[model samples]
Target: MLSKDALDTLFTNARTHNAWLDKPVTDAQLQEIYDLMKWGSTSANCSPARIVFVRSDAEKQKLLGCVSQGNFEKTKTAPVTAIIGMDMEFFEKLPQLFPHADARSWFAGNQANIDATAFRNSSLQGAYFMLAARAVGLDCGPMSGFDADKLNAVFFAGTTVKVNFICNLGYGDAQQLFPRSPRLSFDEACKIV
Candidate 1:
């Protein structure tokens, strides 16, 4: 079990940050975060999620044009923004990622399975990415306010990868936080069989 402090750091005290500090996130830290997140499992180990870290002023400007008005300032100001996407052809790597069996053939030519698996697994990986970021003491503001097609055209052109969401990463500015929202109790949101 994690200590209370650790739990708070990863979950209890973690909040969706809309404001950012002027601090910079390092390349080493980004590498470390990906190293940790990549270990999480995916179905048939397809590992579909691909990430693009936008840290440069030019890239941020490009992204600024892609985000919705509500997300403009936070996204533009955050030290880093990650574009998380899924590779529709992820099954092509199954021989390397899940080599114990003929995993690739299961999804090969099966567009429906490929689509569903990529979406589901990449979404899971995105959650893992957030948790991994939290574990590394960074704050995140995940958003889906942008036009996915536009983002894809801009950042991932000529690739089968597609955007699922964007997350701003930085040392957050707590002074700008909104009031914490409530959550449902166990019985209210879940049920026992």
Candidate 2:
């Protein structure tokens, strides 16, 4: 178990920010987040998540068309929107990522295996990404309310990658936050056995 301060910093004190302060997230900060998130474990070490940082107005406009109305304003005003995606052909990179064995062959030509691996690992990476962002003093707004197909078509066309989620990163406006929501208790949401 972690210390109370560490746990609080990562979870209790971390808020899902919906409004930003017009502050830009430096490229170095983004790289730092990636460096931290990449250390997170994945099945067979198959890290499938790919991120495209949308910071320019042009890029933001491209994403605006894919996100729903609820997410449009917040995402548009954010300093950076990370397009978190999963690569269906991620196994091909196993030769380098999992070089100890023939891991590539393990997922070769299997659509179900590929999809499962991509979705699962990418989702795991997404969680890691959110934590890492919080750890590095950035507020995050993670949202799934978007048109995945349209996002993929606009950003990942001609590729085997698909959008899983999007996260807006920047300095948060605490004044705009709603009351904190409730959470499930350990016994109610977990299994001791």
Candidate 3:
């Protein structure tokens, strides 16, 4: 079993941090987070997630226009806001990530399969990203309270990528947090069929 500290750091102690310090998240740290997330599992290793880190004022302004009002201030003030996305042309990389067979052709011309694979893998990557950020001592505010189509139009225009979610990354201000919310008990949330 994992230590109590490990479990707490990853779950009980982690909060959805909305307020941040003005400190910056270094590019090296961002790359390290991606490196850690890349090792996490995915179907056929389709690893479709693509992230764009928006840190500049102009970029932040563009992102601000795309986010919902509830998320605007937190995102705008974040040291980095990752635009987690899925690449539609992800199958092209199958040769490197899943080379045991002709897996690339399996997704060709199959829109349903393509959509399923991209969304699933990208979602998995997002989860991995959050865990990795926590492991690296960074605070995360993951949100889906935005228009995906507008985000795509603003950030991913002319590209085959679509935004899956936005994660504001930085050092969290615990004082700004509300009291912790309750979660379901094991028996209430799970079934051991």
Candidate 4:
């Protein structure tokens, strides 16, 4: 079990930052986030999440074109905007990632299975990514308010990858944070079987 302070850091006190400080998020920190996130479990171990970290002004400008008006400012000001993508052909690498069994054969040529697994596992990976970022002392602002088609064309053209979501990573501006929203209690949200 983790300590109370650690748990607080990961969940209880974590916030979805809408603004960021001027501090930069480094390449080393980004690598650390992935290193921690990659260990999260996935069905058939199909690790399909591919991230594109947009830091340069050129890349940020491209991203700005795809985001909604509501997301424009936060995303623009963020030090690092991570594009979380899902690869439709992720099964091809299963041989190397899950060498104990023929995992690739299970998803290859099956468009339905491939799509389902890719989306589901990539979504799971996306959640792991946020947790990993928080673990590394970075704040996260995840958003789905973007033109997915445009983003895909801009970031993953001619590839099987599709945008799942985007998240801004940085040292957040706490003064800009809104009051925490309410969440359902365990009994309200879960059932003991």
lDDT of model 2 at residue 62?
92
- Candidate 2 to native Cα RMSD, angstroms: 1.1
| Model 1 C-alpha lDDT per residue in residues 55-102, reported as the tens digit of each score | 999999999999999999999899999999999999889899999999
Model 4 per-residue lDDT tens digits across residues 52-112: 9999999999999999999999999999999999999999999999999999999888999
Index of the highest-lDDT prediction:
4
Q: Please, what are the lDDT tens digits per residue for candidate 2 over residues 105-164?
A: 989988899999899999999999999998899999999999999999999999989998
Q: Lowest-lDDT window of 10 residues in candidate 3?
A: 2-11
How accurate locally, in lDDT, is each candidate? 0.95, 0.94, 0.94, 0.97
TM-score of predicted structure 2: 0.96
Q: Which residue pairs come into collision in candidate 3?
A: none
lDDT of 2 at 161: 91
* Better by TM-score, candidate 3 or 1: 1
Q: Per-prediction count of colliding residue pairs?
A: 0, 0, 0, 0
Give the alpha carbon lDDT tens digit for every residue of 60-104 in model 3.
Answer: 999998889999999988999999999998999999999998999
The segments of candidate 4 whose C-alpha lies over 4 angstroms from its true place after superposition are none
Give candidate 4's root-mean-square deviation (CA, Å): 0.7
Q: For each candidate, C-alpha RMSD in Å?
A: 0.7, 1.1, 1.2, 0.7
